[model samples]
Target chain A: MLELVSQMFSYGFLNRALLVGTLVALCAALLGVSLVLKRYSMIGDGLSHVGFGALSVAMAMQLAPLAVAAPVVVLAAFLLLRISENSRIKGDAAIALIASSSLAIGVIVTSLTSGMNTDVYGYLFGSILAMGAGDVAASVVLSAAVLVLFVLFYNKIFAITFDEAFAQATGVNARGYNLLIALLTAVTIVVGMRIMGAMLISSLIIFPALTAMRVCRSFKGVVITSALVSVVCFFCGMVASFAFSTPAGASIVVANLSAFLLFALVGALRGKLPG
Target chain B: MALISCKGVSLRYENRLAVEDASFEIEAGDYVCIVGENGSGKSTLLKGLLGLKSPDAGSISYGDGLEQRMIGYLPQQTVVQKDFPASVYEVVLSGCLNRRGMRPFYSPAERQIAGRNIERLSIGGLRKKSYRDLSGGQQQRVLLARALCATEKLLLLDEPVTGLDPVVTAELYALIRQLNREGVTVVMVSHDIVCAVHNAGKILHMGTGVLFYGRAEDYPDSEVGRRFLGGDHHA
Candidate 1:
């Protein structure tokens, strides 16, 4: 394991992967707590699909992928918010509508232009080697911004998530905070899609929070535990992927799943113990 | 002086007229209960008072130094909140978010206020407990503590006692009554006309509009109030 760690860090792409992956994991886990509790977990999945479509369009246009995908996915996130808030369309239905349509558009765009090339394949399933130095810098800055914004608005986020109406009544701007959450989620999704792929980026957002909720009783506890769980699982998964030559994203998800199962077992046993 | 005055206010929910041409005034230190049958716009009117919903017609004015943000609100639990993973302290502390304005974190003074409200409600022992772990009555008390942290003057509650048992309901009403006696203005929405008449100083009976608005003492004499209270008597 020590030899593998040394060898993994020796590779520049692996180092970039680890750096960006860990930061994205932290951001996803933090936002995931609110998203899961609000029952908007699928928004991550929907927005990732939107990110994929944007990425595909950017590739076909020969434009900067990150710049193109980021704004488009953010716009889609706002559109999802608007649809959920205004119309008869429920949140889940709206997510499904946008997600499926984006996926369809991405598939058509890829088939029409890219011809199922390795670049498209890399994006479809994720490739750690796909990240460049510029990509790493972008991810780092965006992740830091997400972290700062999250920390700054922690109380407002909690107030809105816990009770939106009550928050609004107290002049907390619940709608604005909700929009902030969506914006952060969109940014996280776009940042994560490069490493985790559109198909699996949302798992990074969801699994850690669910795993933490199994054992943590309070919101702060859940958030802290989720962040730790996400970082550790991502690290372990990255190591395993290096050792076994497996896919990094899938390996991370597997690590998270194992942690979730272990925590669930502990939670169940704790529930049965006499006080 | 009136803390809140609604003059010919009408509110729409989902583009349908849920409340029509409702007019009432809530005086400072008043204990007002808006009572009506299901779908009678009691909760809608409460929303209007809290500024959560604007009047589609007419206006709601706040006076006597009252502002929308200064109004404490205790909304009925939503499905998401039932299983929310938050400590009682965290939930109560969030009430100070409005006053926090632009500051990222809670000030020490805000924390003190949360602690005071928790102690005021006698839930200091449960401050560290997760809100989802509390009993229904205890949850209500935690939320009440949260509301108290928001404002010292006015509280707007929407069907606060809906899920609690009879004993817990009585206890909550008594708690609110005690607060009102201590000069905290309360405007609660409840279907229990008996409890409303018993606790509130004023009652606003509604059936898609303001059927009656006056002193609680006169409510029993009023036709709408008499019918509602008499219906509850047999119920």
Candidate 2:
């Protein structure tokens, strides 16, 4: 197993894929802690659907999917933020509207543009095995932007997550920060689509955060633990995919779920035992 | 000096008026309690005062040059899902975000302020505990501590004692009164009219709108106050 892992890492394509995946995993996990704490896990799901729709449209137009998907998904996220701010429609409802509509639109567009792209399966289920230098570069730039923004607005974002109204009362500009969060999530989803695909991206955002929460006592601890978990899961899943000839994206998600369930079971058993 | 003034403030949600033509003035250093029924627009009034909601046809203004951070607020204790993992200290420190500058890191001064507020509220021991794990009273205290971390001038509370026991309620009220005595202007909404009469110097009797705003002594004799306060002589 170690030999196989070493050989995979020695290859140029595999090396680039691992580097890109590690960067994205770290970025997603850090932001995922805030998303999970704010109870907006569904926003990740909604944004991924928007990314998928953009990808289908891009495919038909012969444009780069990531470039097309990034702006479109970010715009959709801004609209979701606006609509949810109306006080009439709650956050989850707004996300549901976006997710369902985008998914429907994407499926229709994909079917209409058939025969043009025979290898479109790579975009759907993901194919780290087929990653190129271009994909690696894009992922690195996007992850760095996300990381910088996260650091710049950590305190305000934390305040907004705990109690939005209170945050506003304290002069945090809650709406502005909320819109920023939505846009960041949108960008992360677009970048992450190449690794996890739209169908499985939300799991990448949620599982690591949930596992971290079970053991971490502070918000900073949760962020660190989640990023570590995502790194471990990505590496293990990548190697496992190589060894077993399985899909990379699906393997990563399975690894994440396995880690999540293991932590949950340990927590439960510890709870049952006498202190 | 009147720090906050509302003139014929009527807040409406779509077609329904939450608060109709409410006029009142909150003087500096005054402890005012607002008492009303469930749908009496108590929370709505507080929101209007905080600029969270715009009044349909009225004017509201804060004292000139009063820093926005000087107005602290303690919303009702919401039952956040147990899955939330924020610690009490983290929650309280968030109130200092505005004062922490636009930088990513908290300054030592901001940390000192948060620490002082926690110590003042007497919840320093629970700083590391999860917010959701705290009892209702403890949660309220933590929120109050957070509010205090913002400023010491004006505090607004919305139904702060809803789910706590009488003992805990009394303790919280005592703390509020103590803060008021220390020169912090307080505007609080409460369903307990009796408690309001005992603790608050001024009472705003609200039922749909501003029914009466005056000293508690003056309110107990008014017709609107008589109806809401059970027409009792001591009310």
Best by TM-score: 1
Q: How much of the real interface does each model capture, measured as fnat?
A: 0.94, 0.68
Cα error, residue A272 of model 2, in Å, equals 4.3
Clashing pairs in 1: none
Residue pairs with backbone overlap in model 2: none
Off by over 4 Å in 1: B231-235
Measured with C-alpha atoms, the lDDT of residue A59 in candidate 1 is: 93
Q: Give the TM-score of candidate 2.
A: 0.93
Estimate how well candidate 1 is docked, as a DockQ score.
Answer: 0.87
lDDT of 1 by residue, B31-103 (tens): 9998888888888888888888888999999999988998889998999988888999999998888787798
Query: Against the true structure, whose lDDT is highest?
Result: 1
TM-score of 1: 0.97
RMSD of each: 1.8, 2.5
